[model samples]
Target chain A: MKKTVYRIYTSIIFLFLYAPIGTLMVLSFNSSKTRAKWGGFTLKWYSELFQNDAIMKALWNTLAIAFLSAVFASIIGTIACIAMTGMKKKWRSVLLGITNIPMLNADIVTGISLMLLFLTFGFKFGFLTILLSHITFNIPFVILSVMPRMQGLNPSTYEAALDLGAGPVQAFFKVVFPDILPGVLTGFLMAFTMSLDDFIITHFTKGAGVDTLSTKIYTEVKKGIKPEMYALSTLIFIAVILLLLLANSRSKIKSVKTAERGKS
Target chain B: MNKKMLSLPYLFWSIAFILIPLGMIFFYGFTDKTGAFTLENILAISQAEHMKALWLSILLSLISTIICLALAYPLGLILTSMEVNQNGFIIVLFILPMWMNFLLRTLAWQTLLEKTGVINGILSFLHLPSLNIINTPYAIVLGMVYNFLPFMVLPIYNSLAKIDRNVINAAKDLGAGNLYILKRIILPLSFPGIVSGITMVFVPALTTFVISTLLGGSKILLIGNVIEQEFTQASNWYLGSGLSIVLMVFIIINMVLSAIFDKDGEGGLL
Candidate 1:
């Protein structure tokens, strides 16, 4: 009896969670533009989604910003992690606390503050400003992701490489880099995801003419329920589902292998 | 020795991008358009409209955070108690929605809750009275809860999953009943996750302009909406920055609370 209640409750929560995504998927195929009526089942919106120049531009912008910012953040954050190994605990903690400021503060404040920075500096508000803001907000995620791996590093291995006459850069790439690579990759992915989903900061920093998918959708909603927007979201939803499933299965397989190794 | 110089680039970046921008906010917050220092901008929060918006933002976000906690706690309990493999599947399901652009998801709710939208359509088919709450504060709360629920869930689950089963078993082996074990054993141990989760939900919900704009019609204003307008529409940078300072106070308080509770940083997103 108790189990049944839990099951029903879980289902209800899942229903609430998926209902919006399901609506978007269903609406993507509806021939009618309005949600009030279904004109008929149609695939026109998906096709239209590709051909739409404005949205295509926004998509390109989104990808570029996400990729560039993630790459930049990873570089800076990884370097910061490396340098921290040689620093005192006090300064490292202070720097880390500074890093958390962006993550903890409200997005609107970060957004507006960056905007304010651009205005005060007389910097042109365009793609670069948005890119800068993304990198700023994205660094903390990369740092947090990489810090643990950095902390756990076997410094002796790097010293061993150094003692064997491998140069500093060469030693790091040979020993330390390989060890911390996983964390850096994770940080890069996290940064990428955050930049891609970002709307508020982008909305503020993106001045006239530039638009990401989020900003475009915001403007699109004010005009009407464009079925094309739903189509875009559906594609993204499906892509995320597939990628996560792939990642999940791979991890599961790895775990199974580890368990078997333990038994053997 | 020179390896320490590797962080110089980041140090410069932080000073330029992070530190300077923050200083600019203070500069703007305390100055007028003429750039002279003044108390008027910071004091503007006491105006009836701004105060109303601030209170409304606080009230609605509070409601949303509480609802998210109420919903997520049981779900976390269920997830943590499940077989380890099964935990991943449900978590993936929960996380999938977060990948979809949130603005779009919140907009989807606008369709689902509209007068002629899906829910109303279903109600009419069942011979039930149609419900309408779109473009209201209720709709905004719904948006907050829908968008931020995952933030509440993930941290709580992580922390709960970290609890040693032996501790619970020991409690059970003692004279404690199930409810007592939950209250005494699980709750205290899971406080970090709960605190982090609350901070995660509350900060975004409190500072959200997008959710409110998408759901609550223009007539409804949250502090976020007011600050956004002050910058974007009114072009009053001083007023916008000043109001943001007020928002920052609340955010810092939330952060300090989480910092206190999650001292070991067990459940912290950082």
Candidate 2:
């Protein structure tokens, strides 16, 4: 009885969570422009989503910004983590505290602050500003992810590489880099997702004619959201699901192999 | 030793982007258009419109945070009690909805709750009372709870999962009943998670303009909406920055509380 109750409760929560998403997926195939009644199912929206140039552009911008910001943030964040590992304890904590500012502060404040900075400097609120703002926010996420792995690095192996006559750069890369690769990958993925999901920050930082899918959706809110957007969102959702599944399976296989190796 | 120099780029970046930008908010917030330092902008929060918006934002966010806590704590408990393999998959399932666009998700609720919406359609078909809460504070609260529930759940679940089973077993052996154990051990142990979850939910819900704008309609104003309008529509950066500073005070209090409770940073998403 207890187990059944737990199962029922879980099912209700899951339904509540997915109801919106399921509605969106259903609406993508909706033939009627209006959401009130379901018209007969049609695939026209999917085709129309592809044909819509402005939306396609926004989609492209979203992907490009997510990718670029993640890559840049990963580089800077990993380097920061390495530097932090060598720092005095007080200074390291201080830097980490600063890093948390973007993470802990409300998005509106961060967005507004960056907007003030851009305007103060007489900079245009365009792709560059948006990218810069994203990179700033993304860096902390990357650092948070990578810093733990940095702390776990065994110094002996690195010193052993040095004793073996490897150059400092070579020794660090071959010994330390591989050890922290997983953390770095995790950080990069986190940053990418954050950039892709950002709407408020992008809304403030983005200029006229520069629309991420998020900003595009926001603008369309006052006007009715287009059916093509529903189709686009459904596709994006499916893609994320597939990617997560692939990541999950790969991790499962790796864990299984590690278990087997441990038994041996 | 030379590796310490590697932090230069990040140090420069943070100073230029993070610290300097924040400083700009203070600067703008404290100054007038001619750059004269004055407290008028900051004092503007006491004005009728601004104070009402602030109070409403606080009241609604508090309600949403409480609702999220109530809903998520049980779910977290259930999740932690499950098998390890099942736990990971279930947590992932909960987080999956977050991967979708939040705007689109909120927009979905707008469709469902609108008078001519699906929920009402279903209600009328069943001869049940239609939901008239759309475009009200109740709808906004629903949207907040829906959007931020995962943030509350994840942290609580993480902290709950970390509790040692042996400790619970020891408590059971010590003649503690289920209610006593829950109240004494489980609740106290999960305090950090609860604090972190509250901060996470409360901060966003308080600062959210989009959720309120979509669900609350234009008639109801939030502090976030006021600030957003100042920056975007009104083009009054000084007033916007001032209101943001007021909002930041609440956010800072939340951060300080989370920092005090979650010292180990165990409540983080990772």
Candidate 3:
């Protein structure tokens, strides 16, 4: 009886959590001008969204920024993870704590400070500035994601590789690299998602005439919630769900393979 | 050892990209408009009203964090107990909103909370009077909770998933009640997750401006809003930097205090 009650309560909580999101998805196709009224469904908003040049440009900019930031963050973060793993544990902890500051700090503050820094540096607000700032936050995320997997590796694997006549680079690439690939990929995807979703940092750093989807969404909602924004959101949500399913299945496959290896 | 080769790139990037920019932000906090760095800007930020706003941000974040933890603890319990397939589905459902645009999610709440919005529409349909929910602190809390609930849930779930089932079974065999086991065994063991969740939710909630701006209206002010006003509105980058520094200090203090309270420090050890 108690277990059933618990299950029912969990469902209710989940409903509360998902209701607004599910509602937004449903209402994206609502033919009514007002969000409240449930008029007949129509596919007009999505088609309208595609035709808007401004939205298209913004979406492109968002993708570009997300890609650039994720790639840069992945490189820096992988290097940092490699370096940190060799340090004394205490120093490693301190380094990690420092890296995590950007993640924990208020986005508004970070955004403003970065803006101020750009002004002080006499740099223009555009692709480079936004990319640099995004990378700052992204690197920490990547590091956090990658560090665990790095630590989880068997220490003697590298030793065995070296003893087998492999040079340092060869040993790292041949042995260590393959083990932490999942962590690296996870970090890359996380950074990509973060860059895609960020508004606060991008808002402050973006130059004139450069509108990312987040900034565009901010402006549109500030004016009024439009169906086009909802349509865009629905599409973005679907894309994320698809990516998540792919990542989940891929990891499961890897897990099963690992289990089989353990059995052998 | 590849330490020397690796250290070069790590040090170069950290100094050039991370340390320099951070130093510039801190340096600018001390500089006035005359191109000279001064302490005047720091003093200006210490005014009474700014202090109140700082306190308010902390208090509001604390309240929201508490409420989120309340919701998350039970939710985490249920999630951790589920089969892996079901757990994965629940996680997707939970984390999906986090992937959606933050501004849009907050806007969704605004649409739902307004007089003609979904909540009020439901209320009126149920023969109840519509109540004002937007442009208030409550709205800000709602927005924060909505935006960050997953951050709280995920960490707790991660910790609970790692628990040894034999510990619970042993407690059960020893005649411990379910409530006692949860309190003394599960909750104690999950302290790190609780800590991470608190930091994840509380830190962001403390500094959220977009949610407050969209939902809390002009009446509601957080430190984030004040920081924005200083730089963009007031054109006082110095003062804004000071506020940012103060906010950073407060965050450090919060982390330390949480660590201390964690006793084992697992909550804050990270």
- What are the fnat scores of the candidates, in the order listed? 0.78, 0.82, 0.54
DockQ (C-alpha) of model 1?
A: 0.77
In order, the Cα lDDT scores of the candidates are: 0.89, 0.92, 0.82
Listed in order, the DockQ scores are 0.77, 0.80, 0.56
Candidate 1, after superposition: displacement of residue A243 in Å? 1.9
CAPRI tier of model 3: medium
Report how far residue B76 has shifted in candidate 3, in Å.
1.7
For B1-270, candidate 1 gives per-residue lDDT tens digits of 696688798888888888899898999999988989998888999999999999999999999999999999999998777555363676677767877888888888988999999999899999999888999999999999999999999888988988899999998888889999988778888888899899999999999999889999889999999999999999989999999998998998888777877875444333
Candidate 3: misplaced stretches above 4 Å?
A: A34-39, A87-94, A154-167, A246-264, B35-39, B45-49, B83-87, B265-270
Q: Name the lDDT value of residue B134 in candidate 2.
A: 85
Pick by TM-score: 2 or 3, better one = 2
By lDDT, the best candidate is 2
* Cα lDDT of model 2 by residue, A1-264, tens digit: 998988899899998899899999999999999887789999999998989999999999999999999999999999999899889999999999999999999999999999999999999888999999999999999999899999998989999999999998999899999999999999999899899999999988999999999999999988888999999999989998898889788988998999999999
List the candidate 2 regions with Cα displacement exceeding 4 Å: A258-264, B84-87, B261-270
Candidate rank order under DockQ: 2, 1, 3
